[model samples]
Target: MINSNIGWEISKNEFYSENAFSKIFDAVVHRTIINVMAIYKKHIRQIRHFIVCSMGILLLASSCSILPFGEVLFSNSESVSTQPTGTIFYDDFSSTTSGWDRSETDLGGADYMDGSYHILIDEKNTDYFSTLYRNYSDIGLQVDARRIDGPYDNNFGLICRYQDEKNFYAGMISSDGYFGIFKIENGEYKILGHDTMVFSELISAGDTGNRIKLDCYQDFLFLYVNDSLLDVQQDKTFGSGDVGLIAGSFEVSGVHIMFDNFYLTDITQTMNQEKQQ
Candidate 1:
């Protein structure tokens, strides 16, 4: 269901320039999109009828205005001690000058709208991201995200150690209450320590915002939702690169998500308290 002809259009025009890194990242993203499309073609045959019907609904919905703001229904009471004291980067996305991409196309769009970082993917089985053009290693990232529109079956989360799109780690949660940690190395996507996304009751499903936290330090990775730790994984493939927010669609499109209160800090400690228990 991916639109093969549509290119990755971020909000900033400079990103599509002939810059070497941009070229590499763009290629890697397109490759990932193609691979996901192949997967749907292979495994989604049984649901073809369902997809056809869903597409009709999505098309009609897309014709209307998409609201990127909603009521915040959840809070993270988790101890902030797990995050290091040093703030590497933070953005409330209240200004357009924050340097995140803001572009719109026939496929989708990523922009600073309604005082929040908004990402709308109108293409099925497609992923789009708006990254902070900076690099870091062993960091902690936290954000509040919620589904503004589109299917409940969608993906939205944080990415770390993004080295040229091909090598990176993604910790994601679906609006329908599934979560997973993934690694993309050399353009191949693999879930770390799992076969597929695991169901998690901790995630605030549907239109409610869920506080998400991800820590990438040394060889360990941690994913937290709504103040509760969901998964802890280990990997040594990627160590440092850019970081960002990602949103994608599964069987259906129009996966509109808005992110706010993004804070990035150094990773100073492990989940020792949870481990000892």
Candidate 2:
């Protein structure tokens, strides 16, 4: 009996040891699997990060290639000088009597009055006015005008770097409809783009007047109306020259107009330097 009991006890001890060894082996395998999964998850995250960064870089490079550098156009390096080099191409009726010349077209009943200018348009009379400024670059041109008489289709705007009456860059707003940037290529003013608000309306002479601002840089042009940005364009055709104003035709009767606050500058270098600071 004693021998049998001792044998039974030894057998139990051996079975328990084998079970403990099996459990330990399974635990080690499970820990190894967990460690491997963690490594795989870390690798996946790294790969995703790399892909996203690559895409961002490519997108940025593409954008840079398409759009002109803002710094080059609106740089702070250029300085605004008090001494004006560019002439005030024209004004309705100025107190200084500087570089403006007054001339009349076949259009009758056109005259200057109340510190403003007026032009009459008819079948026989198609009134037109023009002026020229010399030796100016990089300037902002502004004019305030209102239609006091005539149909809604009366037309007026500023012409910059004008090679002639028909060959130049014209920023015009029509009382009839449409305001846009235009270029006179072969004696015809080609409409580049038109503002939706102005385009949808049927503007006529003696309609509402608006403030127009034109900024010309090296290869860039911007137009603003009523202190708001209306349009921007890139043209290397005419960079620096004279500026002028136009009023006439395309409408029955005529319209009265006024202009003021004419300014010009060559602060291209000064504007660029200021940007860095």
Candidate 3:
């Protein structure tokens, strides 16, 4: 009976999740729709009672899903993290920018396309960025970045501990192959750590790909590329603040960047343990 109950509940959700899912996510709709239908049909007999309820619940979940396009697309993205538990936020930019916002003057602007978020940079718009509406702390955040145009001399990566327009920590890498960690305080940019050039093999040469990860726990932070740990930093200049996506131009502009698999996993379980004592 329990097994039957679970199956029905699952299929009900499967049915509802795919109904409106194909609308915003036309790219992977055909295959995903067929697969979801198959699962529902396969388990329909066992979980018939839960079908209606599941449909309602699933539709709700779909509307509110971290990545509403579908789990398949979300799972396949390069920046998606496997967190055992605790997630402050996770997005593929597949549905919509839930809490992320930016102005039209923000270079090329941010938009969702083909299961990813795209930013078109040009000479007129050298650098662009978008940030979450709220600040998040002690979280592991990551994203996949690729230049879609121009020279490989540009830089793109994550912005965390962001206090405002003039304050934040940028964990960035250049396409020509260099990485830097910087802290912008009161309009002055300070280099906290940097590698003039390293991990060329880890980053694609031209308009290709690079998976960058940043884990910020307390005062310590770790940065990674291509699934490999590159460097770590410990600082207290900023505690909890907004997270954002950033791009900068060097040699030239019109350097388009596509960011996907934007994931944020927070340390929620330990929010108040020792301090309670």
Candidate 4:
């Protein structure tokens, strides 16, 4: 009976030892799995942070490209001109170094010159100018201009009473050439007047300079190129406001044009009242 009891106790002890070993092995495996899961979670968090940072950098770069880099000048009420009894709108091309806004057809793919705010149009594409005014009525407008470079068709003029891209009045002078006044109605250029006294041709192919003057009063329109009188046409088609610059293509080289002196006055008033003394 004592031996049997001793054998039973040994059997019980061996069973308990195996059970304890199995429990310890299970605990080790569970702990290793938990540690590996924690490491994987940490790696995922790092990847997420990297992806977010990359997205932020891309967004910042895109924003910088879309916005314009320059200063814009709005209307200055204090800078109003009192002379010529009119207002002068001047853009010295200081702030707006990038050309003004206009149509592609009118712009004609002109290139920008370095260190200057003027658009350079070559003979290949001379029909490019800034559209200054549109849709205005009943005022005498004058512009002060200086010639920079000539040769080709350095003819600078005004587009008046413009109804669209096709219809308007044009008064222009060629460098060392004659003055021309024409009306464009229904997409046709009709000559109103031409004076060769100042210049033999519409555009002088030399380096001589010229000044042009235009006056629109009631139904009477007068144009002067240099010292020669070009046209005195009467037309009631256009009644008022806004003027623009005119340019054309024909072996035309680029020009540096500066417009400063502006005189606009109400001509309906008496001569004594309109005259500036």
Candidate 5:
């Protein structure tokens, strides 16, 4: 489960009870039909409304085929996710940020203060620090993060498959409504799936807490925030390496961010142990 947190745990029975598809189809049909009818009514005098009406009929037909009246794709007995079986390592950060040893700060630093990990970026300069607790080949890592101080124009999230501070994969979310996954090779940064950064409704804005998760299974990487799957892509740059956290400044310095409740589950190790047992 790439934690693309996008999965329906609702059983097929529950799905119908919820009437999700009907609600969606109703809204789409009503709005689309209304707009098409308005256009047809207006253009009827000029005989152009026929094209509009034809389109509306085609749209209605396609919409019916898109989901049909009542058809559920996935159904299950319990809340579900396609998660790999593994041993999970968890830290609520109640004690220290000690094992997060490697740091590269330009004008920023990561601290464990008042029982939470904080990344404070100075306005004087802009940079990020990579804090690695441990490394794994196929793994899933996630952390709870929110802004504590500084401007909303900052970026903070998880860094995984880290070959080093220079070369690694970064999954980043900004307070200004932007999210992206980047491949940093030899200190050069490039977007993974698309050339441009993206904005997502799945991402919470402002002071809201976000649980950013990155899943690394083989060469495929998936991004999930607040339990919603947002992005996915495949790459073959690096395999097994250290995983950690990162924060950077954008508009101003002194960007304060706090992270807690971290989880790192090693799929590789778990699989090996299971074989022996």
Candidate 6:
């Protein structure tokens, strides 16, 4: 539900608990992956041999699924809405030496292309993301993103508090207008706000550009689409980690996305500014 004070409040009672979400996600996703892999093996058995290659290893390890974190690890006694200030990191992807991963494989690729960071996935039920590898905590991240060439049934957005492929928080919106805040803790995926992705009219449909913003401050996570708050939840499994962009294909393969004008700011600075004011 939309809150005047906060964008959207996710009630733990109304949504799937940690164990329940994990069990269901594990069962459903394991079966789906097995089925997809069977089809993959049938069509392209040779791809399995590529795992020894570096790019193959990279993509396989980078692949992530939409998941969630269980029960709150800790609770913040104080809560405050922050106004971002003081840029911490900014990348326009105009240069290839900006420390983003560049890898290409038959499944997909991620690299700096034509002044933007690009990610493409040619495999079903898989996600590939590229991180800046910078450590951070309490960051406000924003980026301009759009599907370049892919199915409308895809997932792409920003990621924060990213410990690794196995642990991170993703604020995601599909091309078809679904949005959710998900996290993977210790290789177990769970959706923080809802049992499944929730549709939002604020998300731009099709290949149109959307300004996606995610605020990872303390235990609170807020996601905004086109400056409209889309999802809000609280979780403290990960306090700090890397930040990056992610794109994933569902049942349909070929999910390609490009991100540009990415910037991250320190939320603590904003909070201090508020206190002074």
Colliding pairs, model 4: 136-240, 136-241, 137-240, 137-241, 138-240, 177-199
Quantify all predictions' global Cα lDDT against the true fold: 0.66, 0.44, 0.55, 0.40, 0.57, 0.65
Location of the lowest summed lDDT over 10 successive residues in candidate 3: 47-56
Q: Which stretches of candidate 1 lie over 4 Å from their true place?
A: 1-85, 269-277
List model 1 lDDT by residue over 1-277, tens digit each: 3333432222241112122232221212222222221112222321110011111123222321232334542233323334335667777777888877655544576767656778887777777776677898888899888888899988889999988644678899989998889786654456777756788888988888898889998899999998899999999988888888888887788788888878897666434434566
Q: For residues 1-277, could you state the per-residue lDDT of candidate 5 as single tens digits?
A: 0122222223332211222222211212221211100001111211000000111122333321111112321221222223435537666656653464322122344555555566666542243444453668888888888887678766778878877544678788877667778776643455677655577888888988788988887888888898888899999998978787777665466677777777787756654777799
**Which one wins on lDDT?**
1
Runs off by more than 4 Å, candidate 6 = 1-84, 274-277
TM-score of each: 0.71, 0.56, 0.62, 0.52, 0.63, 0.71
Where model 4 places Cα greater than 4 Å from the true spot, the runs are 1-83, 88-119, 123-126, 150-152, 194-209, 226-229, 251-258, 269-277
**Model 6 Cα lDDT, one tens digit per residue, 1-277:** 1112211112342321233212111212221111111001112211111011112233333433211222332222222224336677777777878877666655566766667777777777667777777888898898888887779978888889987555789898889998878876644446785657777888889978788999999899999988898878999899999888888777778777878788898878876787899
How would the candidate models be sorted by lDDT, starting from the highest? Answer: 1, 6, 5, 3, 2, 4
Return whichever of 2 and 6 wins on lDDT. Answer: 6
Residue 246 in candidate 1 has what lDDT?
84
**lDDT tens digits, residues 1-75, model 4?**
011111111123111111122211111111110000000110111100000011111221121012221342122
For model 6, what is the C-alpha lDDT against the true structure?
A: 0.65
lDDT tens digits, residue span 79-166, model 2: 2223333434335353424444343322322333334444334321132444445645676676665555556555567767766443
lDDT of 3 by residue, 1-277 (tens): 0111111112232322223333221112111110111111112211110000111112212321222221222223454546424565778776754545422322234445666776555443145566775678777678888877666767688888877654678787777776666665643344455323244466666756888877767887777787887777788999988787877555366666778878776654534443565
Let me know the TM-score candidate 3 reaches against the reference structure.
0.62
Candidate 5: which pairs clash? Answer: 4-229, 121-254, 122-253, 122-254, 123-253, 123-254
Candidate 2 vs. true structure, TM-score: 0.56
